[model samples]
Target: MKNLLVILFSQALVNNFMLARILGTCPFIGVSQQVETATGMSLAVVFVMTMASAISWLVQHLILNPLNMGYLQTVAFILVIAALVQLIEMLLKKNSPGLYKALGIYLPLITTNCAVLGVAIVNIGAGYSFVESAVSGAAGGLGWGLAIIVFAAIRERQQLAPIPKAMQGFPLALVTTGLLAMAFLGFSGFNVAKFVGM
Candidate 1:
């Protein structure tokens, strides 16, 4: 219980996917122009990240590590994530048409999102158990969701503000993200290694 809490808090805030790790900056900037789109993207990412983490951990520990195939980690994890994204897209479309309409487009895009890969790689790098990996992955997804939502809100408001032609779209969004990253750095001391009894 304590370790799970540590993983949740550390990944969500101290090691946030966008502000701290800088993963998934593509969607974080691109799809965040509108709140609704950003929300959809976030939901897809949350599902993908959690599922990817769990599957990757299983593959790594139960299959690759024991077989002396650790070098294949990257390739295997990427394939798993892609498959999971596709499965989720199909499931959502079948079970919930409304959610499918809302988040379907983002599903294919998330297959390439670095944040998903980052979480899986980070889990292996940290040598986390299956439970820790799942907790951290979910927390990371939540953090990514929080980041995109905040960015969307900021961008929506910025749309009304006067801006220079040179710094109009992506440049301005990047600058905003930079500031958010700077603020997030303040929480870095909440290190997971220490907090999670590593």
Candidate 2:
């Protein structure tokens, strides 16, 4: 249990997909204009990442490794991720039209999001068990969402703050992201593996 908590915290903070791994930047910038949209995207990402990690783990252990087909890992993982994104898209379209529309192209673009694929590949590389992979995937998504939402809040306020014309838009957001990433770097010295007894 302590190990699981450590994994979750490590992924969600110390090794955030956004601040640390630097994945899924497209939607991080696109859908993060509003907190509501960011929340919805984050929930969807958490669900998909968790499920994809589990399924990919099963496929790797059960099929790929057994048949000596390890070379197909990337293709196999992307296929799984693409299918999951499509499924989520349909479900969202039917259950929540407003969110579906708000998400727009970004929802479908999740198929290519490096964070999703990165989690699946990282799970396999780390040799994490099924439960750990799921936890890590969800945590990574949570971290990505946390970073984007917080950055969105900052941008929201920045809209009103009198700022230099040169750094009004993307330039300012980029600088803020760099600073936030540096702040997250402070967690690097805290050894998650030591706490988890790994």
Which candidate's TM-score is highest?
A: 2
lDDT of 1 by residue, 100-132 (tens): 675545568788999999999999999889989
Cα shift from native, residue 26, model 1 (Å): 1.1
Q: How accurate locally, in lDDT, is each candidate?
A: 0.87, 0.90
Candidate 2, residues 64-165: lDDT per residue as tens digits? 999999999999999999999999999999999999999999999889999999999998999999999999999988888889889888888888899999
Of candidate 2, the 10-residue stretch with the lowest lDDT total is 189-198
The local lDDT score (0 to 100) that residue 30 gets in candidate 2 is 87
What TM-score would each prediction reach against the true structure?
0.89, 0.94
* Candidate 2: Cα lDDT at 71: 100
User: Every model's Cα RMSD, please?
Assistant: 2.5, 1.5
lDDT top scorer:
2
